[model samples]
Target: GRALSELDSGMNRVQAMRSYAGDQLNRADRLESDMKDQALTQEGARSRAEDIDMITALSQVETQKVGLQAALQSYAQMQKLSLFNYIG
Candidate 1:
């Protein structure tokens, strides 16, 4: 009976250790998944920031082009109206 009890105690200890190890593995897996999700979120935010910057830059270029065209047109009109045309 004593030998049987000793064997049973050892088996129980082993089972407890196994359960603890399983729990630790599950915790590690959850942590790894959370990290991956955070990384993806950060990447998406960075991509959006870059896209906004590009769009803003494109809009500025278009505004500048419009201003330049208007200036050229005004210059052309002034050149056509010379001193002789204005005086007469």
Candidate 2:
């Protein structure tokens, strides 16, 4: 009878350990999912920031191109109005 009681106790201990291991496995899986979600969120934010920067850079380039064209036009007009033409 004593040996039977000891065997039962050992079985219960094994069952408890199995249950704990299963719970830990489930927790690990949840943590992995959360990490993946966080990484995706960060990547999305980075992509948006880069897109905004590119748009701003493109706008600045357009503005500079316009300014350069205006300056070139003014320079050409000045060249046409020479001192030699005015004096002679």
Candidate 3:
């Protein structure tokens, strides 16, 4: 009867250990899911901040190029009107 009682106690300890292991696995799964959600949310926010609107940026670039070309032409014309060329 003592041996049988000891066996029951051992079985109870094993069951308790199994329960603890199961709880740990459940916590790990919840943490993994939460991390995945956080990563996705951050990625979306980063895209909004860093990604440019192609049409607007392209338009601004085109406008600046045109302005630069006009400025260069004006500078060249001013250089032609200098009196230093004739005095050389």
RMSD for each of the candidates: 17.3, 15.9, 12.9
How high is each candidate's TM-score? 0.59, 0.58, 0.58
* CA lDDT, candidate 2, residue 53: 75
Candidate lDDT scores, in order, read 0.96, 0.96, 0.96
- Stretches off by above 4 angstroms in model 1 are 54-88
> Which should have the higher TM-score, number 1 or number 3?
1
Candidate 2: C-alpha lDDT:
0.96
- Candidate 1, residues 39-84, lDDT tens digits: the string is 9999999998777877788899999999999999999999989999
- Compared to the true structure, candidate 3 yields what TM-score? 0.58
Error of 2 at 64 (Å): 27
Q: Which stretches of candidate 3 lie over 4 Å from their true place?
A: 52-88
- lDDT per residue as tens, model 3, 2-70: 999999999999999999999999999999999999999999989986897989988999999999999
Count clashes in each candidate, considering only residues at least 3 apart in sequence or on different chains. Answer: 0, 0, 0
Ranking by TM-score: 1, 2, 3
Error of 2 at 78 (Å): 60
